[model samples]
Target: MSVQFVGLKEINGPLVVLDNVSNVGYEEMVELVLEDGSVRTGRVVLLEDKKAVIQVFEGTRGLSLTNTKTRMLGHPMEIPLSTEILGRILSGSGKPIDGLGEIFAERSADINGKPINPVSRTYPRNYIRTGISSIDALMTLIRGQKLPIFSGSGMNHNKLAVQIVRQAKVTKDGGQPSDEKFCVVFAAMGVKNDVADYFKSSFEESGVLKNVVMFLNLSNDPIIERILTPRCALTVAEYLAFEHDMHVLVILTDMTSYAEALREFSSSKGEIPGRKGYPGYLYSDLASIYERAGIINGHKGSVTQIPILTMPNDDITHPVPDLTGYITEGQIVLDRSLDLMGTYPPVSVLPSLSRLMKDGIGEGYTRADHSALANQLFASYAKVQDARSLASVIGEEELSPIDKNYLEFGTYFERFFINQSFEEERTIDQTLDLGWKLLALLPREELDRLDSKLLDEHYHPEDARMFRGA
Candidate 1:
């Protein structure tokens, strides 16, 4: 038998308070029956002193206190999982929206998945090539790593995200795709209809829709759904990676929107606000989502994450990105300044980093000189910035010839190295070789960070011209 309440004590934004309730567990699913015989689903979010607060997944637009009845389902929210989920488009609430009908699930699992034991976690290795020069040659993304992309509003992060999904590959030595299974799980939270359609059509046009699973929570959808979007997507990823043994790349975009939803819900509950009006448990809440990514011991597959969030006012100190920086492995920060310069995928390589980059590159994984070339590129770019600042203080003609060379290097570096078409995908070797090609524009003696042996083999200007000619 189930417990049914005749009426709600109070109705708040997306929340219904049931007073004098007993034995109601947190996160227990609830079903609301309206007078018109329509049913909606919700879950208990707060339980205290014989009172329970249920958050309805569907918006509470048509319900009234006298006409609404709530039933406790005695269980938490769970998503049906199966191999058939691939190629399907689902709503944030995990319902099929593609008109393909329901999936025959193998089993239902909790959306909030269990944390992997620390001892059971295998160190992440191997590289997932994103085909972007800035990412591949500099901040290399390793399998089982959680790297976030930080952007601001009006930036083209959506295009960048799609490009990564379209071009990313799992590769071993010689830049060949590994025999391991690879797939993508993309989730969009609080996005506009056009943005959602863009992702769907982009995947379909690229002919990779069969290997991608997409969950979309649109702007007009219930706010509660935004909170569940990434979790529902990751649940599918966890099912695919651990149970079916597939390398899954999970992309959750506009996490700032998700965070905003959290703030709205928290404000409704009247909880004590933390930094910038976010919840006090914000870090743990984000950790639960991000820490789900990794390679488990004895597992043949991995779950890598590229969570994208827009920084409010491009403020790195904002709570959303600030907390994310602590949780994620590293960040690929997009620059508005670069975008103004007409750069596609305008990645700011200076602040960007990949903590797991070293483990995934080198002799056996990528080229043997990959590390040396990346280090030298970073060092030389730093000098270019200095030279530009010096020229700004004094006239360019007053600067030394070496300073002028650095300025020229910066210009070409941004044009030829950092900027690339979204449709143009480069292999790791191409990215590394291009880095050397750009370095050849500078005096070879300035390349102090590169190994002497690598400089002799890959950095000669004569060889660059010969290779370009060939």
Candidate 2:
């Protein structure tokens, strides 16, 4: 038998407090029948003996305390899933908004997913190529790895993200597409309408829309719905990867907005705030999302995550990003200074890292020379920074000849190496070859990071001279 409660105890901001409720569990779904007979959805956020507080997905505005009735659904919030989800657009709360009609779901799953057992997990080793040289060659993205991109407001992380979606592919040794079913699951929480349209058009233009499933929660939507956006997307992803045997890439954007919604809700609930006025469970909350990504033992499919969050004033230590750094495998940080200088992607090479890069590259994966080439690039770029700082003090005209060469190298590093046309997709081989071509510009003695054998085969001063002249 189902129980209904009338005359709610209280109506807080986006929350309704019901008294004398029995057999209610945390996160269980709720229904509100207003006096006007319109229905609204909610979930149990906090529960006490015979008293349950529900956070309404649609804000509570017209509900009269005396007339409204609340019903507790026996199950938690769930999303319907099927292969029919691809090429479809859904609301933040998992409703179809694309006018395509409801999905004929094969089954439904709890939005609050189960944590994967650590003992049954397999380490991520497969490399996913994004066709961006800066990422593919330097900060490699491994399948089943949780790598967050740290960006500041006004940076071009959106452009970079779109390019990544368009170019991401599963490849075996020598860059051939692996025989795996690949799909993308994208969730946007609290983003502007224009931003959401841009993503839709970009994916459609690239012809990858058929392989994508998008959940959009705009800034104008109710604050409470933002909380369910990512969880809903991940739930579908888990179904595709674990049940359907499809490799999935899940992208959650503007996580800062999500965190803000969490803070607002926590404050309303009278929960004590932790760092920066965020809930103390922020770390556990993030882990629940990030830990869902990985390769499960005996499963052919995997889930890789690229969560994009804008740091408040570029502060990496903000509670949102700070907590994320602790749970994720590594981070891809975007440089505001580089963006100011007209660099596309504007990736901060030194600060960005991929912890699983070592396991994914080299030998039969990308290339045997991938390890050495990456090391040499990092070393040389570090030198370029040093040389630039020195020149700033002594003036480029007064610098030694070796320092001047480094100044020129830095220009090429940014222009030809890091910067690429948004429409152009480069292969791993092409990126590595371009690295050698740039390295050849430097004198042989300066390339100390390269082994003697690599230098003998790849170093061609004559070719470098001709290319530089041309």
Q: For model 1, what is the C-alpha lDDT against the true structure?
A: 0.92
lDDT of 2 by residue, 183-263 (tens): 999999998999999999999998999999999999999988898999999999999999999999999998899999999
Q: What's the residue-level lDDT of 48 in candidate 2? A: 83
TM, every model:
0.98, 0.98
Candidate 2 stretches greater than 4 Å from native: none
Once superposed on the true structure, which residue ranges of model 1 sit more than 4 Å away at CA? 463-470
How much does each candidate deviate from the true structure in C-alpha RMSD?
1.7, 1.1
lDDT of 1 by residue, 1-470 (tens): 89899888888889998989887888899999998989999999998898899999887879888869999998889999999999999999899999999999999998988999999999998899999999988999999999999999999999999999899889978667788799999999999999999999999999989999999999999889999999999999999999999999999999999999999999999999999999999899999999999999888889999999999999999998999999999999999999999999899989999999998899889888999899999999999999989999998999999999899888888988898998899988889888988898788889999768888888767644533343
Best by TM-score: 2
Cand. 2 Cα-lDDT: 0.91
